[model samples]
Target: MSDAPGPDQAGPQTQLPDPPRPPLPPTAPERGGPRARLLGIAGLVLTVLFLPAGLVLSIAALVTGVRSRKRARRVLAPAPGAVAGIVLAVISLVLALSQITLYAIAWDDLNGYVTCRESALTIDDKKTCQDEYLPRIEHRFHLPKGSLRQDPSWP
Candidate 1:
């Protein structure tokens, strides 16, 4: 006496149309245009890992990051790695510049210190080397007297 359809009995089925999907945004930054993630990562690695090439690579990273940001803005898309890349590049640039300055300004002094330390045969000899190095270096920087003390582990 059941009115419902039974097994093997076909019932009337009406399919509803799929819900309308909102169209994608105007443009996707992550989609098709030149991806800057590789550059960003390369710049970051160069800055942190290889300082010899960091001076050049840092500048490259900075330029690429800035360009990426500009391009993203021009296209009105969100930038993913631009800001991070720029920040890291700036830090690396500073470190690279400082390294260059130290080498350029105190090359002879540093060379002398290394040679003296290498030839030192005893703790007293090393201490003497430290004494000579500290004064010269302090004078170069115009540091106040007693500003820098010799390391106890000069050996």
Candidate 2:
């Protein structure tokens, strides 16, 4: 055989370069803190448990999560996982809070003085009750006489 190899005899070229790998995206949620994510989950859990107070926390968590996501997108590649987590948490929180708020309002409308009475029923009840009760429990804490009005439906 000749010194030069035949086509069939030639092996595949060893010099071929490897195909480049695509770069992976970076991960960073906007606002650079865990606060939004943490608050979101905590708010959701609390909302499920404590209701009224949780509702406030849920609102806070939703607002913060939204702000954080918007901010994170502006600064770097958005962390989709974190965003999703935040969204789920926030939604859970809002739903929880809304449910509780609705229940409270319904309770108020259906049982005019029950909330007030419950507030004043026992010394132990007073300690555990909400501040909203402050206005009803004590004679000194009265709404302005003209403040009473027809119950307004929520929009």
Candidate 3:
């Protein structure tokens, strides 16, 4: 036989290169800090819980939420509660403004009731004043008779 293998003889097989793998998906960047998260949480809390100072608190919440979102963007982080805080703050502001408007509209009527209640010395007299005032308030607001009740809760 010759030194080279014949066509029937098997020689060493050539190795093929590996098929290219698909690239791995890129990962999300790490968040920078907790300042934005804290601000957003605080703003959301203030907007929801402290409703007595409605207009002022709502404005404050709005400001903080805006700041939180801005800071988060600057830090390349996500703003978690900032959007909720802003939305609630706007809703609170609208309710607060509507309350103020209604109060202004009912000022004289409310004042008369207040003066009557304050001047009355006896429980019977206060009850009488309330009885007279309730109907008027109900009528003005187009509510059912006895629908609105006021309790001074004084001793």
- Candidate 1, residue 130: how far the Cα is off, in Å: 1.5
Off by over 4 Å in 1: 1-50, 150-155
Indicate whether candidate 1 or candidate 2 has the larger lDDT: 1
lDDT against the true structure, each candidate: 0.70, 0.58, 0.66
lDDT of 2 by residue, 1-155 (tens): 66777877875567878999998644445442356667667777777788766667666666666666776768764544456546756687658857866566556443544554455767655444433443343323355532333224310
Which scores higher on lDDT, 1 or 3?
A: 1
lDDT of 2 at 32: 27
Q: Provide TM-scores for the models.
A: 0.63, 0.42, 0.56
**Residue pairs whose backbone atoms clash in candidate 3:** none
Better of 1 and 2 by TM-score: 1
lDDT of 1 by residue, 1-155 (tens): 78789998989889999999999863444332233445545655775677667667667767777776777888788777667767777777887777778778878877888899999999999878878886777787787755666445533
Candidate 3 lDDT over residue span 40-144, tens digit each: 344445535664555565676677677767777776766666676677777777766666777788887788899999999999998888788878877888988
Q: Which stretches of candidate 3 lie over 4 Å from their true place?
A: 1-52, 71-75, 149-155
C-alpha RMSD between model 3 and the true structure: 10.1
Worst lDDT 10-window in candidate 3: 26-35
